[model samples]
Target: MISYRWLLFIVLFVGIFATNYLAMTVKEPLAASAAFTLMVLSVYGLEKFYNRGPEKVTDERTDLINMKAFYYGSLALIVTLMFEFIWLVSEDYETAVLMAKYLLMPFGAMIAVVVLSKAYLERVM
Candidate 1:
């Protein structure tokens, strides 16, 4: 059986992927927003469940891994935004906005995966 951490990651991955796919296919702002919200809530719930209690605190290594994940994810998001900007200039603003909106969930999911993987590796090996 997969560990709880890996199961959580898989759930997050699927949620983000589904959200992005829905956003792309539905082409409705409200629908996209709802999907995004669901993804965010799922992530928050996972974090809460994994952490177990309000009084528990994060360690330095966890903080560092999270920071590194954010750094890398931000870098990737920036590049994607730049590409979207180029697309906007060349194609149309609406298209670029749609692409960017669709990207947000996956980018967030990527960050979660990276941080969790780092933490899991630290714990196991």
Candidate 2:
């Protein structure tokens, strides 16, 4: 049987991909937001299912791995944002909000991937 963690990973990856694709193709905020909402719900549900109720003990290794992943992911996001800012400034762009939103996509995706990986490893190993 496939683990819940792998299911979550697949859901998140597909959701993000579909959201971005729809955002680009349809250019509809509502559609993109719906896709994002699905991703968030899946993650939350998996967390609750795995760590709460009958499963009283939380996985320490999963937590540690998630923390480490988050740290590195955040650092990389910061660096990417800095470079994007530099590029935007060089190009004489004045849309700070837009730039921030653009940067958020990758950052959010990275966090999702990290969390999914931790959950997957926890279940498999």
Q: TM-scores of all models?
A: 0.43, 0.46
lDDT of 2 by residue, 1-125 (tens): 77987888898899878766655556565566667667767776887777776633557765665576566667666645554454444344457457877768777887787778778776776
Backbone clash pairs for candidate 1 read none
Identify the candidate with maximal lDDT: 2
Task: Point out where model 1 deviates above 4 Å.
Answer: 53-125
Q: Which ten contiguous residues of candidate 1 have the minimum total lDDT?
A: 82-91
Q: For model 2, which pairs clash? A: none
Candidate 2 residue runs with Cα over 4 Å from true position: 54-125
Residue 49 displacement in candidate 1 (angstroms): 1.1
lDDT of 1 by residue, 1-125 (tens): 67778877887787656655554554444454555566657766877777785664778766765565666566667645643444353445477778778877987887687768777867764
TM-score of model number 2: 0.46
